[model samples]
Target: MASPTRPGPAVAILLARGGSKGIPGKNLKPVGGLSLVARSVVAARQARSVAAIYVSTDDARIAAEAERYGARVIDRPAAIADDTATSESGWLHALGLIRADHPAVSRLVLLQCTSPFTTGADIDGCLAAMEDRQAACAVTVIEDHSFLWTSGPDGFGKGINHDEAGQRQRRQDLPPTWRESGAIYCVRVADFERVGRRFCGPVALYPVAHPPVEIDTPLDLRLCDMIARSGEDQTTGVADARLRPLKALVMDFDGVHTDDTASVDENGIESVTVSRSDGMGLELLKKSGRFRLLILSKERNPVVSRRAEKLGLECLQAREDKLAVLDEWLSGNGLSWEEVLYVGNDINDAGPMQRAGLGACPRDAHPSVVPLAGWVVPVDGGKGVLRAIADRLLALA
Candidate 1:
């Protein structure tokens, strides 16, 4: 391991091979509203010790995406990118190129694109552990408590840990074990080159309390997508400087405020449920006295007016042209689109969302609006969407 005062910058290398047998183009697939490779790049950017990020891949699309997310691209050779090729070959080749241009680089952090839940803190922790323990490398691991078994040539199962003659032991009495999460690997560059391997000398295991899901098959990807959409993943917090200077907050009424659902009785009466937590969040935002909140809706329903009155916010309903109305309102208030944070859940709201400086949407918003949104809150509409956005704004304040 290197000392804390190591004279060079720590570079992070993310290897994403294009050819995946289990899932084709898996690296480019979206997870948590971000591509797998892009997620790795974003997490790497959050690490304070990582000065530069490089993506090694043979696919041109992956290269373009890596550059789009602020990472240098290394066009890996096909020989080293094949299914049988080990990651060490790609790392060595990429390191060779990086070291040629950056002679002062002292450490290398290898990040896997498959682990979408890996955070910047995890990467920093690995690097910190490496230096603190004076170990040649540090790898992320998770505690494992599963019993082990092995099959003999005769097709008989045998206990790998306990004796077959002994009675089954309690799980708590079993020895502690750890398994690699394949989320992160940090190594001393000099030692790595000298030994031609990641674990050339003493290795340290950095245990992750709750490891993010790893995408290997279609089911894994789907499970991760559901977790992200449900807001169960804790790594969705996005830190953008633009969120700090927000002066106004505009939202759509149907799906942004309500769940875009309504119940009607035979008497032709309609009712919608609204979250009290959302109202409290809005109240807190109003107390800040820094933002002007408004609701823009295309529906001409009294429910919209009633909810607005309860929240003490100005309501504009029966407006088919939300963008035009929003423009007029902004000009009347002596404000510009740059000061507004717009939240929408449908195509109609896309125009205003795109026009606003900071566009956001709820987790279950329309598919078309999700990509255009700068922030996709974890809560659904008529739920805690407003509260989530309000909390994010308050944090920035």
Candidate 2:
């Protein structure tokens, strides 16, 4: 990472206020298969000039999610967490917290979790602009020349044209203008503290004209969802179809979630050891108002059944030919294969795992299964494997 060019000391402040009147909890909402917070965290970390990343939020859930995504969380005070609190206010409060720790922070990069389209490259470029221009601050904008109507100091103004009979002017003849999109803002920390505004004297404009639409309402969220999911992987540029809501989460039993260990009792009953970390991960995943979970196990052990029931997971035990059982379960539940994610650990699971829309395995999974997985959780089984996967998926929001 290149050192930042903002005066002296610098840090990135990611503001994520919990309350949203236009779109509730929109900061945590998903875009491109990730929550808005997750996307920002990833991008911030990727920036070359960023030394550290902090997420400011009042909601414990948002803080927990941010930490899981590798961002430091600063507990946003109630005074600055209200719906009416402006971004400028949050920036100042976070600055105070950052200054106390570093004591010499001279630059503050105010990042909003509301927009997900900005990339780490965009952030690095914006910061680099400060180094190049030696300006007080740098802000992002997009060129927009579409037909626009403006109200004068008086209300009710018309479009640019005044006469109906006039020939349509060429598009280039119109004045080109840039609109602030709140995608990225870079400023000197000392300058920001002195003046309560995000921008200061000699503000440089960083044009990020890449196609962007900020999420400010339910309609905006839905539209971005459509753009992210339906967009083709091809170069032509169309958004992927929005992912349908998760109906069910199909998980594997041994080695995929729980450690492959068993304690044999004096009476010859076997016990499979599980981890509390795994349970914690599941609770967060379930709390997100997404899928109904189902655990499939080849073993018929009573312990497996007990644990599944304890976690509110539907269990299918002693299941051979796992695909057939999965099909039957979907038919009975009126669900489809594409809505399910199959997690597994060994070659035996390959057949069933391949049939699901998304497949995952732990890093310690069988070598073959690792290649088959769409995403491999970082931790081994009995660890926070599920949580790793959930956090990644959540960021895609």
Candidate 3:
């Protein structure tokens, strides 16, 4: 908490390390459609409480990215340049730099590049939590006790439970575990300087009770990439706005998600094939904590429903007009077309394509649909097109 008598301006310092062992240059690697570091920088810039944003890094490329997203640059010292360096050190350095020139800086927000899913609300919520409760620090927490395990001095296998039959206990019956999701952190600048630490004083915990994901390893990055395609960012001023639950992702199934292939059999059955990789990718997208994945196809085919069921996606098959179906979906589900992302690759898809606020098109989409696409993917149809597009959508967002 800043001195009660004189609360000063709030500043956000994002620390980005360009080098990574698991995924080289992961911070710079494109996620959804933007660099990993840019996600944090943009979120911080959008926070109401944050007055100034700064990026501290030793790498020139990282420094440039930070500046690109509207943040002051603080060249990190080499002593804290290696993998062994703690983020706390870099944060302190950037804080000191600010305090030296600007004595009125009161609160400091810490943003990380690894957690791309953190929205503007996450940042504001952390800062608000600190100020509202007069706490010295605040951070984002994800509650999980479902699949935890620990080892004691005996070095034995454990299920994060004493009894293997723990599944019989109700969810609330067991103790809850908190994981620091490295999304948002707020601290009183004065206290941070006084104690030379972040988590030392009276702290407030704000649970991120939405679809939350973190990018740590390559696998985590891939999962984060999947989360980006869910159209959760449909709300205007998401970070600053009150937390709103995203109900569904109304998607177009034909040329948008598939290659629009067909094969004739001896029985005179038409089977328009789909990409196996794209199907698997949708399964991953469905696994995200948030989003109601639905497939909207104008053509009637049992294969679409079968694939949707296998991927745990809802199928709205056999609709002549996707717009009419989208309207019914919104009416029944109490949503707006703008809240959805219509990914299409043909002229028939243009109706819903223009309706969704977040629209996407395949690289090989019809020329008519290309001009209306919010995101035109790079992959061709019938291949890993959806996955490639999904990856960019998540990163850009």
Candidate 4:
């Protein structure tokens, strides 16, 4: 008897085709405040067995989305992107490219963007099944109890699982059958290469309790959105554990509070717009009694002070060196950097953001500041940035 093959590092490949006949731009469609491709990449990142993640696509938007979620992109060819093309061709191309740099990867985990409900645990389960059973491939399946039927050439419906002539059997007495979920597939690299197919040799079925949902039409997309909004399809929590025990919430006024825009009058007086939702968020935080809020701005504009007063937050203005002011204020209040959560949106806020314990920014924040931010809200500034952060903080509280 031969010993079972040990599982090795595996690379997760997510195939996101750019063209969709049923639903246009379906891959980039947002579900639960996250793009479909981004959700898949995040799920893959959560798996411990997955060493790296790669997205194969021909669409520029999909490629950018994949990179935004921290996944390498494999530019798929046009030939393989047509409706007649198959997913296997794209997978083979991606595997070849990945093997060029990561030769140690022995297994391939194929994920579909259509199946948004697939979790990281499902991928790990499939990998475990392949290793424990010593099978060449493992595929996800859902326990299906429906009686199957087929159409004959004579245009008559015939039973495929039971004899139509015999008495109907009880549902409990029916034999167990499984339906392909089309969510996840894990296979040995060597076996896949040998047969050029996902199921080359002995295959194992990994069963999951949740029914798989694939987005193939507009109805499917709307159903997914509804499920996500209902909080039933929430795959992961957006809150970060490192933001706990937060004492102070500091923020830059211009880009962090407003939309990074100012209307200047002929007299050089400027005004900025702020979100009412953001003000409500500040009120909630203040009511929590767990956090002290402050606004630090480089501009000496009275608008900043006025807005800060409206929110009942302490305001510091005309600070050329924001970090110095922040440190001095921390020391004066007997607070440390570890207890502060700073939010900024531009290069001016970069230094201070880095000095804080938890740094965050809006979705439209400057590129340089984004890398420094520990959290990036889904909404832009002056829209719902503060509201989003406040929700996360309140959840922790």
Candidate 5:
């Protein structure tokens, strides 16, 4: 019998250290309502080719946030997590660990938390470029059309892209130049190991349409936040299509159904308040018979099941790995992720939200969760959030 070839690996690696001289806790800083670490992980998860995502971080908080966004955490050594260490150190260490656990890993997609605007399409582009060109590495870049100038020792500006003594030429006449985006890099594992660097053997450039946005200081963070908000405002028309799909609707009970707050008496009994309007909305959705509704909760409290019972909806409670359970449920129910809409309000719900076709959240959802949501209902959690979302989905119907 002929030997079978191993499948090419689809893995992504990210490096995030705790120390940041320019901006303390930089990896955890929110830009677009999501921490940089979470944003990168979500991007990796979005890529159709990516099967495993690993984050190398020494910081406990960064590791927790990365995991919340669907990434495995690699405990980076103190030696490689410091400011002085090059990024290659952390990536090489992570590669070793990832390969040990997943021996089939053949290539790695490296992502940077500083590049908050990086998306799954960018990663996929690099991967495709590498494969199509048979290159060892591929990187994201943007076309640079701006004229370049440099000050000489004689205190005179000199043109670097064109002849200063000859007649001026149109910008379009000049040869195209590409500037590295510093957002995504795809490299063959063997080539990276041999060269001890990202760029090895033949390199390919995957040009991206978006401007290069790198976060290095506080001002950059603020600017990126503004850009994100502007994008959200302009993307409503596209976001509406996410609601048009029908098959299943999954929700987190505590925050999506309640106010994310509860009271406990001296006797140890806990009580929570929910909106009757939300119940009516759920009833209407049930009557439609076009959607499968589920309450997926991490809380072990009995009230979760009680509420689901009253609403006449199926409920799964105390799920530590909501995404895993949700996947199993989807497989059993014969539905695809693209056909379902997920609603959540906190860190724990991030992974499932990113995995679903459409993610919806209450206005007051955690900052990290907000960026993952396709729709942010006007109402806060437990404040008729369900009613508001149901109205929007039904309007499309």
Candidate 6:
């Protein structure tokens, strides 16, 4: 039975392995510009109820990546890491290792990397549901309204959730069914250990708003990427949450402002074209007075300064270490990284982009930076990057 008072904060255990027949190295595969395993860690870290995060993996690369994202790695045995091993085996092994060190951990959370859209809020909701309902387990689920069928032994298709011979019922007439999202699962550690199963007792279902997006094949990966790029309300509520506290908007100059191209005359005069629409968008944001804007450029060209001056935005030029500059600016302006949105289109911007509250990139940005971006604009660099982002953030306000 769930105790009204929780014994302690939950610990999240993520299982990521190396081999995948459907998509090779699936765990490391990037969905929405972040690796599946890394995204899971990010979501776990964001959960206020999660006290510790662990990754159970046999692959060295997965282990390293899990650690890179601030999760402790549990060296899963080669036997259990193979395809034949059930997920329960991995969780039990990881839980034993976790309990050895953190004896006070009573709540156990299992996060799946395949569910790319899982958010910290979802995890917390599941944990809260388990506690509030006094249930032994809670899992994320989504409302399902669909007609199901099954091939009966009589060699005829029969309705599974409804009567085929009876009066046809509207989809809305059917009682709602809860389908597991396979995102977050919270359970009492003792119950799981004793029963050797996730659903050891009464289970609570915590419904999430986002549609289920699980990455198992290449097509799923592509679809997730598109959803992430579109930044839809259904799937991007977590990302939009990051933008809610936005106090500053920092942008990289070259690709973001100039299409990463320049025209040179015989006189060595270089010129670049910018979108007037983007200019208007930035101007509107400036007028709104909600954000402090700055253009950070690796180029020392006077054009960078002139453009910033024209826009009446702060300028930081020729900074190889853009994150260091960003840190100083945040500290000086009394802001945190979680309250800033940084946009970049190249390798140099990757570090700061990942460190910012929401890292965004253009559609045509370099392959390296694309995966590192949290949001990708539909348009290419300099074509309306600022305008697209401006519209989204302003709408949120």
Leading candidate by TM-score? 6
User: What is the lDDT, from 0 to 100, of the residue 169 in candidate 6?
Assistant: 98
Between prediction 4 and prediction 6, the one with superior TM-score is 6
| Of candidates 5 and 1, the better by TM-score | 5
* lDDT tens per residue, model 3, 89-187: 998888879887677888888987887777666788887778777889998999876756677578975667435554566666667778788777888
Off by over 4 Å in 4: 1-10, 45-52, 117-181, 200-212, 231-252, 290-301, 314-361, 366-376
Model 3 poorest ten-residue lDDT run: 234-243
Model 1 residue 94 lDDT? 98
Compose the digit string of candidate 2's lDDT tens values, residues 265-349.
Answer: 8999987778777777777777876776888988788888888877877899998889999999999988888877777888778
Stretches off by above 4 angstroms in model 5 are 1-7, 151-155, 232-254, 262-338, 344-397
Of candidates 5 and 3, the better by lDDT: 5
**Candidate 1 has what TM-score?**
0.65
Model 4, residue 44: C-alpha shift (Å): 4.0
Cα lDDT tens digits for candidate 1, 1-397: 4565654689999999988999999999988677888778867876778988899999999998887656889999999999899989999999989977678888899999888887777888998888888888999999887788899788998877666669988877777888888889999988898998888788988998654468899999998888766644545555555666679999899887889999998988888989999999999999999899998899889889999999999989999998889889999998999999999999898899888987888867776766566666657788888998887778774
Tens-place lDDT per residue, model 5, 85-170, is 99888889998899877888888999998988777767878888888878888899999887778887899988788776689878
TM-score of each: 0.65, 0.58, 0.58, 0.73, 0.70, 0.74
User: lDDT per residue, candidate 4, 1-397, as tens digits?
Assistant: 1147565689999989888889889899987677889778877875668988999999999998887665889999999988998888999999999988698888999998888777767788998988888888999999877777899789998888776778998776778888888889988988898888999789989998654577888888888877776644434333344668579999899887999999999999898889999999889999998898999999788999889888989999999998899989999998999888999998899888888877888867876676456565556888878987787787774
Off by over 4 Å in 2: 1-9, 152-167, 231-397
How much lDDT does each candidate structure score?
Answer: 0.84, 0.72, 0.71, 0.83, 0.82, 0.84
lDDT of 3 at 238: 33
